[model samples]
Target: MPEVKEFRLPDLGEGLTEAEIVRWLVEVGEVVAVDQPVVEVETAKAMVEVPCPYGGVVTARFGEEGTELPVGAPLLTVAVGAPAETAAEPASAESSGNVLVGYGTGAPAARRRRVRRPGVGVPPLSDGSADGSADRSAVGDPAAPDGPEAGGHRRSSLRGPGAAATGGEAGPVAVVSPLVRKLAREHGLDLRALSGSGRDGLILRADVERALRAAAAPPEAVPEPTSAVAPRVPAAERIPLRGVRGAVAEKLGRSRREIPDATCWVDADATELLAARRAMNAADGPKVSLLALLARICTAALARYPGLNATVDTEAREIVRLPGVHLGFAAQTERGLVVPVVRDAHLRSAAGLSEEIARLTEAARSGTLTPADLTGGTFTLNNYGVFGVDGSTPIINHPEAAMLGVGRIAPKPWVHQGELAVRHVVQLSFTFDHRVCDGGTAGGFLRYVADCVEQPAVLLRSL
Candidate 1:
């Protein structure tokens, strides 16, 4: 007989505690290889494929699709040590080490043991058997009561249907997912009052949603005719804020609540800057982007005024100035807006910065950026000009001291030297934390950036 091994969900990095099952790659009784991706899960950070460490026939799966599970919950069970013809190597050799962030498979897992509660007994599977078979009751079906031969434990509801008629006592609630409990609590719905339609009477998210809809339904009553006709009202739609959108919301909200910020804007003549970019790209081995040129200007400004390149330590009541610059640029994709950082950006030249910015942008658009790529940003550059806007007051990314916003550069009427002429002009907006610097420092930084935009030669002095 093969030994059964239970595989629990491992901790995804970046302080994520849970993930929702998007899809399952393998089914029950299917053979899986060592370190093979068994399921696809979506965390608050990104979509990840979780690989199983042990290689054998999958015996049981715990959750269905769209089910949210916390860390250390049982994901599946695998039966190892199959017949020699089925497996090429022994089960002991098939075990892997360091598969994910937290757990590993160097030794065989302990056998499954049941722990009895004070006044409740462990219920068997829906089929009243101990064999590891696929449970179909998870698909909105009520489970049958356990027989005497199985466990002799009767499935009792707390306040479900027919409680007043039988006058039965309340039992343990059949709920395991935290998401279901949260949904019920938010809507002021009592989980004990409704009957579950899941495996072994386990309550699911769908049950709570159904109860809410029932409560919100209007009562059937005849209405009297009015003098004027009533207008039809459209139904409102609700969307759950989860994944990338949810993360962005929480961070932006915290920034608004904590940071006392101020914004300053300057309009600069960018005709010379555009011409300089054209000249640089004309003879460069790698084409330099306009954004990269702006980034180069930003690095030069930070060198002159290091006060803007720092974060406030609230606990220590100190402003810690960072030595190196990890520049972050905002990129909007189909998923949402994401900031990808360029490590040691101050050391990179125009060509190097262009290369790194291109790589990170591609990764962001394809939804392949890791948590590390999205964090540890010392400063941020937001180019909202891509949306064809003239100007915007940018919100500072949380914990970062400052952000630079660039608007679209277009032809405008301006007094060039001694004559009124049509020139390419752009708007630059800078938002900074009031705690880091005063108005004079923020104004100096913005003026330096505007000068670079007006005359590219000013940037050459810093270079």
Candidate 2:
């Protein structure tokens, strides 16, 4: 007989608790090889293909596509081994060495004796005698009332409807999945009073969750008799804050609530910067991006004002200055806005920063950016200018001390060289956590950035 092994969903790391099934690669009764990609799931961070460890016939699949399942929930069941003669090779022969989130490759699992219904594992005795009773005793519960003669049986670990029926007066409730029962227990719901919508009236987790929600819903308020009916109120559409959007919302909310932030803005002449960029690109190997140039400028400014590249240690009542500049730049994607970080931005040239920015931006747009790529930033550069805006006091990416916002650089009327002229001009807005420094430090940092923008040669000293 083939031994049935159940595989559970593994944690995809980064503290993700659940994933939604995007697609299934196999179906029931299909033979699968070890380490085969069984299902593709979308977690809060990224989409991942989960592989199975056992190579055998797929006995069952648990969740449907589009179903969201918690980590450790059953993914599928595989039956290992074949006919007695052909399956002489131990079940360990099908064990996989490839490891996933929760499961790791190790010694083949030792076979354990389990009580299962007939046609599943061991056959039950036909005679209504001592042999049948002894079989029941071997699998625990000699006291169980479901005997061979009763036309129903019970498994020690997995109790079906028959086992529920054998539980004295109330009999057995139709529940096969333990997750459903656990959900009911956690929510203080009684399964006996609810009707299940599953096959053979088996209780499901959705049923339990539905019962919980119904129990939680407030009672309808009684309205007194009125002369007129109230006008129908418009219903507002609600978008679920999850995935990238949820993460952004949480960080922004925290930054606003905890950080005593202030903003400072200045207009800078960018004709020289544009000319320098053109000259560099005209003779360069890899084209340098304007954002990358701005990023380099920010890094240099941070070296002069180190306090801006730091996070607040509220518990310790100290500001912790970071050593390396892990500069994060905001990129707008189809999934929403994401900030992909470039490690050691201070060490990179404008060209190097440009390449990394391109790679990370592409990854962000494709929704392939990992959790590591999105976190651990000392400062942020948000060029909202791409959206054609002139100025914005953008929120700081939480835990980071400051964010530099750049607006559109266009031909504007400005006093250049003591005369009013149309020059390439841009607005630079600096938003900093007030706890990290006073207005003097913030003003100094903004002034230096403006100077770099006005005179690109000033950055040569830092380079």
Q: Best by TM-score, which number?
A: 1
lDDT (Cα, tens digit) per residue for candidate 1, span 1-463: 6666778889887888888775565555445666666666667766666778887666667786556889899888776654323222333426676646332234433221111112111122221125644432221112222333213445432224323335663433466554465466557677777778986556778888999999989868868666677866866756567777778899899899989999999999999999998998899499899999999999999999998999989899999999999999999976688889999999999899999999999988776677778889999999999999989998899899999999999999999999999999999999999999999999999999999999989977877
lDDT of 2 by residue, 1-463 (tens): 7777788898677787888765565544434556666676766665566778886655667765546789999998777763222221233336675555332234432222222233434233121233332111111222333443222433232233344334633343566543355355545566767777787566687787887888768779879667777966756635556556667898899999999999999999999999999999999499999999999999999999988899999999999999999999999976578899999999999999999999999988776787678878899999999999999999999999999999999999989889999999999999999999999999999999999999999998997
**How many angstroms is residue 20 displaced in model 1 relative to the true structure, after the best TM-score fit?**
2.7
* C-alpha RMSD by candidate, in order: 11.4, 13.0
- lDDT per model vs. reference: 0.74, 0.73
After superposition, candidate 2 runs with Cα above 4 Å error: 29-31, 81-235
Residue 454 CA error for candidate 2 (Å)? 1.5
> Where does candidate 1 stray beyond 4 Å?
83-93, 99-235
For model 1 the local lDDT of residue 448 reads 95
